[model samples]
Target: MQVAARGPAALTSGRQRPCRPACAGLWPAPTGLSARCRATAEVEADSAVAGWEEREERGTRFVAGPAFYRPESCAGRDLAVLAAALQRKRTGRLRVLDVMAASGMRGARYLLQADADEVWCNDLAPDAAMHSTMTYNLCTAAAAHAEAANAAPGTDPAAANSHASNASTNGGSSDHSAGSSAAGGGPVAADGPAGAEGAAARRQAAAAWEARARVVRLEGLTRDVCEWDFPPLPPASPDPEAGVKAETIASSGTLGAQPSDEGAGTSQPTSSSPGASAEGRTEERPGPEGSAQAGPGPGSSAGDAAAPVRRVRITHADANRLLTNCFMREDYYDLVDVDSFGSETQFLPAAIDAVRFGGLLYLTSTDGFTSSGKRPERALAAYGCYPRATPWANEQGLRMLIGAAVREAAARGVVLRPVFSLYSYHGPVFRVMLRATSSAEWESRHYGFLGHCFVHGDNYTLGWRSLAGAVCRCDSRGKLRKSEEEPQQAPADASASAVEGSAATEPEPSASPDEVKAPGPSGAPTPTSTPAPTPLVVAGPMWTGPLHDAAELRAMAAEAERRGWTGTGLPKSAEPGGNRAKSSRNSRPLQELLQLLIEEADPRLAPGFISVDDSLSRRLARPPPRDALIEALREEGFAAARCHLESRAIRTNACMEDVLTVAEQRLGIKRRR
Candidate 1:
């Protein structure tokens, strides 16, 4: 092993410095501390290990090496934990893969906080590759020290001191000063050890440091870091039956050979060892030939084996190719996170393929234009669904994205049930988590089309059925009578004539060329149904199923509440000041958003939403407040709740006419048209 020496300039004054306090063993300081102070401490401690600065956020310490790190992403990191927790009930060991791990922060946190058994942090950036390696070394060392300390409860002071002395000698001369300073206030005597108590403390510290160095050695022996470009995915198979086989074949071509260690490799530690500065130093020490590989040391408990391993293999390769290889190997991951820069559509297929049955798949899409209906053609081409320009575009966009993922997975005999979905207006991205399973029947039932009527602001979900001749109530033009099974309600205050006039104003239905015709007894074509003069624009072959699993969401909410994360800006009942006050008290807006989503989720509910303002825009009188509308619906024995999709929207089982009647009576609004 070859180690580099640190210059005097890197050392603090000649006075010895105490061992920086370890927050919970080798893990960085706990979260909630001042970020700046935590960062400074981390830098001071690991300066000898690498050149990059470091920062701690949400209890995870990340080095600001060559990769980009954003403090604002802390909330997203928290959501990742929540997602993992939701999946923990279904799996014993959670294997995670961060396809675009920039600083390895997310992956590291998963290991430390999310009960992950293993994490593969892969990044394409050259700087990230180097920094991730260093991060793994630093974290592993801390873990080893923590384990060693735990394993050895008590020892004779003299023996501990002797152990410390030997550790200091092997660690190189640089660590001597740090150890001595930690022992006492001033410089140590030339010959004798510091006072007995001080000597023992210093020795213990030195032993821990040396243990970290040994771990780095073991890691270097077993793992290899490689830099290789990810190859393009093989062309999609034209035959549905051959799709899986073709994908496997293509993956082999792209990643058949083990990657070579092209970039900076892990060098062996020097004789001077752990005491050497970590900065810009490269060591190359080959492992003993034909020696048995090392694993978690004696200190590791059986329980610790199930926890995330400290060692990691940092690979610099294309994210897509890496995912494809995982699929080809049948190496299914418990959790696969694909946080791409833009649209995640390109990676969704591979991600779905790589996740194990009953596992979780988390995806993020920043391409709002495509999913939000700003770029309809792109949305259709990418998601195989049409995105409508509506007041609830953000929510629609999220569903469209989810619908795309569902379709992609279903094509490969996989069924993905959405567990959680987020349209973070703040982050301006759509994030979703789904549970993967294999059930062709379930997939068929879960995917369908949504037909929306702009004229009456009504929508219907058509599951596994043709959309031909579908007409909204407003477009029936009195040809189709209202179903007798439909509940009838009297208008709150509108005159009978006013109600009749409102119904008459609807445009006449007309026949469309696409309508499917069934022959009558004589084989003559069935009547050509006329299309509504004001047509109901078909919005999707998109996911018309429920956007959330109600039971799962409720369970998640309970977990959040247990963790003291239940505060949402939403009102639980018709309470005043509660919303504003609770919102004010919420330190975690992301959690609040999640809670709000849970409170509003209903699997029986349909997809589209009604914007109270947009619906009553043509009315001459002022529109009813959102809360008032919800309150009125409930009073009338209808189930109504605030919609997470839009601020001014309410979701309810009540018909549009009933909602409007309630609004008119409650707010004194009158339709002008």
Candidate 2:
């Protein structure tokens, strides 16, 4: 009974269906429950979180209510998983901060699939706490169920649970474990187990149930849900004793005093409750010297001492203010993910501030209008760059967003390098992963402006100082034409002479007398001695750096391959029962897209791509195939590759003239005049 992935329409058709058996172990839908009971339970669960539907991806099940569930964002989630995996690979443990948690699906998946040690899922909505807690409960319960099933007849229940836990903790196949048993295709015989296996199973189930009950009790005791604003706390005053107290707390691993209940809504977990024994419950007390001491709360058998307690803290507060607080507190994270609805510019400063040097920041910007050049005024106002609406607008948008982030970090004396940049057409947003560091030697060399000539398909990038005399190769009328006089050969050191030679060799088919203009007071006239100034449209202060770190992308690709996430050689059990085909389809594109990005990621090259067709549409009767032009350019010893920015575009290290010459020769088309 596999449950396939369905769209929003199918989900809201008002038809009630029974929970599939395969999905039962991964969620709270028990096998013994009747169809009506299952439906009722699901409804009750949804009611707790404002009617959000439950969805599964990569074998992790999470609830996504109408308020935060966006189908178009599934690709973003995939990238998040990739980032989490990469971080987990680099660091042994993962601690994630999901600021706008919504249904907490992203955080839950990180915990379940990315091997996250702890996740602080935060959302401003009061019900967010309940939603995240419920998600956690479901996942833990599923793990417990798998543990009971996997236990051998004579195995100790605790030992079996430990073995089952390894599968999830190692970021292996928890979903497959559940599906094998719950889907009714496993080696375990459900009814024939009055023997040792049955007893072990019963013990396992009891332990699982107890764990779930304990979580519920803790929630009731602490009132995990709250509605609050997170404002930046004031800087701490210098205290000579503070350092001593902190050192004592670090050594002991415990808070000196019990958390207050005044604003927190409830008291701490009581010692007298059921399962409150030393092995099951934690206790806190102040040290005799009045310094904070942290250690295992009251719970302590020598065996339990080996197992460290993993703590997860959730707060209802403004994400921006929380980031600011973290910055002020000098608290840093290895990975900071900021997934916002609109522009992420407002939060970039604090986010950058909160990350440790060399840490990663995953940012999402859904403000297409500003980043895509649809509103240049707004783009300049927000990102401090003029985004041009070109055929490769998506690429420009992503670069503009990165440029803004780099500028923001630089102002605070931080250097950021983009490790990966993704522009999803479906979301119409730009997502980038950048690594941050502190460096006083950072200069503005990587920052510059782009000069483009639409008529001749010529473009130039100039540094801040060079921009003063930068000019487009086209004439004033926006056409490239040969000079009537023989151009005098200037000294080899003269750059202006080289520009003139390049332009004079190829001229426009038709020319107007008004095309030529005298040079301005800024510099000497063109080497061709044209009377008129060159026509150029400059756009920049944009990022002229590589959008991805080649080494990092290659590692990610390898990780994807190792996980069988590249849509090839996946185990039958690894597929998420109903949506296997869809999942495979999605993964294929991601793999190809990654390959394309890798090929185009050359930091030494410029940022924008050239549309071969668009450039030669008027000059030639028929434009040559993209591959033909790229091949020709490569043969000429120029670095050339198909660009991911546009379908018929290519990115190359060759100058505009070189590119045009290759295209003209490959297509057997003469340049117009």
RMSD of each: 16.9, 15.0
The reply for model 2, stretches above 4 Å from the true place, is: 1-54, 128-307, 474-533, 567-588, 667-673
Query: What's the TM-score of every candidate structure?
Result: 0.60, 0.62
Cand. 2 TM to true fold: 0.62
Which candidate number would show the highest TM-score if scored against the true structure?
2
What tens-digit string does per-residue lDDT give for candidate 1 at 1-673?
A: 1121222122111122222221212223336768897887655434323323333444333344446564545546666765664343222235577888776767655644443444666666644224333344234323422232233423211111112222211110000110110111121111223343322332233323322332121112222232111111111112222233324422422111111111111121112233322211111211111101233211111112222122333454567866775564344566798877778898888888777555678888878777667888888888887777755677667777888998888787667777777665544677788877665534444455555566666554443334553445443321111222244452332221111112211111231212211101111222368443344456666665556665555555554444443322112231222334443211235456666576566533445667777765644366578888788766754556666656677775454665666666666767556
Candidate 2 RMSD computed on C-alpha atoms after optimal superposition onto the true structure? 15.0
lDDT tens digits, residue span 520-569, model 2 = 22123345666544565667777755778665666566555555454322
Model 1 backbone overlap count: 16
